[model samples]
Target: MFDIYNIGSLILTLSILYLSANKYHRLLKLERLENAGASPEEYNAYDKRLRLECILLIVIMGTATILSQFTNALTVAVFMIILGIILKIIINKCCPIPK
Candidate 1:
């Protein structure tokens, strides 16, 4: 029986996966730049920042997936929404795009 929680989870999961895919492509691009002789320290720093963003997306995806299985649908939805917001703030503060 599909319900609102399932729909929400589906939307959240798809969007997070899209973000992850974009980040993965970017990492590939970053690797190409590094191979083309970008500075080692700077390249690694940018690579690490990109990785942290990926990790955040994965964490949210995992949380949404797991919580959707439980009984308290309302709580899970609210918690995930709040968690997403908090993580977004952290991402903005911690992961500034490299110039």
Candidate 2:
């Protein structure tokens, strides 16, 4: 049955999956920046943007979880969780990291 524990675990799984994607993006960007000898100012800007992106990501996932609660559709949440994993893999291997 749907419960707080199940919701909590879903949130945790979603967060970990997407955060790993974010980490992959960061590493790729850092390597690119280092190879290009990017300026500290550029790095600062990138960091700020990435932080904002992460905050937005968290908010979106949290909202999604909250909405799914009322609907009692853990399946939707599970789908999102699986999607996040696929996204992580795409970020790591296929898609170019955004600036």
Candidate 3:
């Protein structure tokens, strides 16, 4: 009893989270007023944001894994993971966000 809908949902959830977190971080970095040089403050701030992104990604993926097990929808789960990865690649490849 594989449910594609659930898989799609999981995939959509992860993709949204990753895309949004990335956008938010990028925007924040862009907002920085520093010029010509990097400082400890900037490095720490960037590191913190990067850690947050990693945490969120792991949480989302873990949730998806749990949902897949409960729903017994391996196909859907795999599809969702693949779709998310593909979309991420496409976005990175096509849109550099004009830095």
Candidate 4:
């Protein structure tokens, strides 16, 4: 049975996962920019923000996954996998690599 807590937890979990993936993707892009000789000053602020967001997302996702076990492990796992795919879609939409 789905309750408010379970529903909220699911939403929060998916959000954190997507955000974490997004931040990591951005970090990779930053590295590519650096390799391509982009100025550090130009990318530094975004680099810092992405790293911080990635760290925060790791903590949030870990805690959420642990807490989710108390409710339903299989359901949470399925949701996480589905949300991961959704995150991939979002990342593609949010950041298409320059051709």
Candidate 5:
């Protein structure tokens, strides 16, 4: 059966994963910048942004996961796992660790 709920679930899961990973990378980069002697004000601004991003991602993930409950449990679970791996690849490509 072609379930729209499943599709939506997949999309939301993938999006949340990507955004979360990207935010994490940004946080890491901010830390690197701080260690590289960024101004305290600049670091504080970046830190606040990172924290806001984390909170937003959490809300998005929570909402999406709740909505995903309408879909088949097993399907959602499997697709989520696959999407998570893909998200990892995207994170690596888009946000490599600072040297």
Candidate 6:
């Protein structure tokens, strides 16, 4: 009932916090890349991609929160977070970093 909505709202709030922390981490990465003499074009492209991912994360989290209203709160939150982590892993793969 109302608890479900509360949980969903909590999940949404956490998602925003997670996104902010992630953006800060990426900004640090960007600074390091710049210090390493990465080209302006490359840096700009990476920044653009990060911005797009942030936008998409906001949309997805919002949608999931709304959908949670008609579903089980705990299950919806767990699934959305799991899926987001998997996506983050995939994006990490694209970065050429060893797993």
TM-score of every prediction relative to native: 0.49, 0.63, 0.36, 0.41, 0.42, 0.59
Report how far off residue 44 is in candidate 1 (Å). 1.9
Q: Please, what are the lDDT tens digits per residue for candidate 4 over residues 1-99?
A: 436676567757777678877867996889897888876565765566565555555554654466475667776677656665665565556544434
Q: Which parts of model 1 are misplaced by more than 4 Å?
A: 1-26, 35-38, 71-81, 95-99
Candidates 2 and 3 compared by lDDT, better number: 2
Tens-place lDDT digits, model 5, residues 36-79: 99877667666665555455544545544654666776766776
List, residue by residue over 1-99, the lDDT tens digit for candidate 3.
Answer: 566777667767777777777778766664573444556566556555555545556554756665665666776577557756765665456433323
> Comparing candidate 2 with candidate 6, which one achieves the higher lDDT?
6
What candidate 3 gets wrong by more than 4 Å, as runs, is 1-36, 72-99
**RMSD for each of the candidates:** 6.2, 7.5, 8.9, 7.5, 8.3, 5.2
In TM-score terms, which candidate is top? 2
lDDT for model 5 comes to: 0.64
Minimal lDDT window, size 10, model 2: 90-99
lDDT for each residue of candidate 1 in 1-99, tens digit (9 for 90 to 100): 436677577757776777868777877879797788877666866777777666766677667766666647787778878987898788768766555
- TM-score, predicted candidate 6 vs. hidden true structure: 0.59
Q: Which pairs, if any, clash in model 4?
A: none
Model 4 error, position 69 (Å): 4.5
Candidate 4's TM-score: 0.41
Q: What is the lDDT of residue 21 in candidate 6?
A: 86
lDDT tens string, model 6, 1-98? Answer: 54666867777796879788878988998999899988877787677667756755776677677667687888878877887887677665664322
Q: Is 4 or 6 the stronger prediction by lDDT? A: 6
List the global CA lDDT of all models. Answer: 0.73, 0.70, 0.61, 0.64, 0.64, 0.73
Where is model 6 more than 4 Å wrong at Cα?
Answer: 1-16, 73-99
